[model samples]
Target: MNSGIGPMVKSQSSIPLYAIILILCLIAIIGGYFLSKKYPLNTNELKAIFEKEDGESNDITEPSGDIGNSYAAIDSSGVESGEHGHYATPLSQVNKHNIDEVFHVAGELVDYDTADQVCKQYGARLASYDELLHAYQHGAEWCNYGWSQNQTAYYPTQKKTWERLQYGKTELEKTMCGVPGLNGGRFKKNMKFNVNCFGKRPDKPDTDFVHPKLPKKPTKEQSKEELKHFDDLVVIPYNRKRWSRKDYEPHPV
Candidate 1:
């Protein structure tokens, strides 16, 4: 029946198959091109884009010219800056403010005026020498106070410190060089002393400071060592508690 037309029909079927193959090949090529470009552009292009965008930004500007030349720091140099702490002192407990507690937790401040002011902002403060020592112990034991009965850890000793509750001041001594509580001379008339805590160490300078209207206490020759030691006074950490006999079991006086 057909003749030449039948053969052409068969050829047309093969043409459709070839067309499908070509379409698939094109799609694969296109997919590969996109897949290869998935990563971000190279550094040069990124730098260019960044520079272009940065050039458009204008907010606060840096200081210019002579304005920088006239600037100076008003603060006096060589004074204590931040909270004082021991070598074993962990940063988490340092508060340059008041220690409000009676028993002196590691960070309690002894004064409300200076140290306490800074610490109250964050609910922390300077620790008393003993408290500071305890805090140092906490640091050595990773702040774990439980099961701590070691004498070496409970006392100051830079020579010995381990995973125990050692409160020795060897490390603390180096860190708390001239701090008020650490290197204090002795207790004064108004000073509240904890004989139980600080042993019999006088908490204030043995001699008295001269008030313009008041009389002087001791001359350098009278107690020269104490006067010399006074110069070494550094800011010592302390607790804010004013202990009375009632506060302690046997009376803390």
Candidate 2:
């Protein structure tokens, strides 16, 4: 009897080619994984791999109309505070033509109608009560009270005293006017308070800005002449006798 080694060799040779190929592939994959640990792919390498596989361009562009750096710092009620003072936000958020521009006319008391006119002169309107409250909430400084568009009077106070009755009770915070409520009620329309103004941006950029010629600033000589003229003006109800040095004398304490 022949001890048949040839029969066993023939049986192994009969195994499928695909089986051999699969076993070789598994070995290659394990070796590749270990090799990858030694030589890890970087960002550029990974990106190149993705580009090659996806067949896509690498020139990525940021989408247009994004807010980007053009942030409108105004609050919900359309108000912004700046180095100059608080100002009403422009109607258009896209173009902040005057967002930080100090456009308000304060420091002088004026009636409601006069305040309106003052704002009109500056191409603005008196800011409404809602608008003022919005500014106040956005950390606007309030001083000496002012008139709102609705012909009411108010001075901005700390957040949520009586105006924003947060806890079903009115809490007083340290502000000028003592007790708290947003509405100073309706003042006599003629009664004066400094005005806060609101302006709207033009629908488009003011390309025709040159049409309405802006006044030139006074030269040094012109300013001196004007100053001299103003100083030369005499103010009198002919009260020379009444306005004597004696009038300014302090009384005995």
Q: Best TM-score goes to which candidate?
A: 2
Model 1 Cα lDDT, one tens digit per residue, 25-134:
99999988898699645887667778779885434442111100001101112121212212212235433322222112232323222333333333443334555344
Using all chains and alpha carbons, the TM-scores for the candidates as numbered come to 0.17, 0.35
| CA displacement after TM-score superposition, residue 68 of candidate 2 (Å) | 26
The TM-score that candidate 1 achieves is 0.17
lDDT of 1 at 224: 59
Candidate 1: list runs displaced more than 4 Å.
1-112, 139-157, 160-253
User: How does each model score on lDDT?
Assistant: 0.30, 0.49
User: Which has the greatest lDDT?
Assistant: 2
Q: Which residue segments of model 2 deviate by more than 4 Å?
A: 1-97, 100-104, 158-185, 200-253
Q: How accurate is candidate 2 locally (lDDT)?
A: 0.49
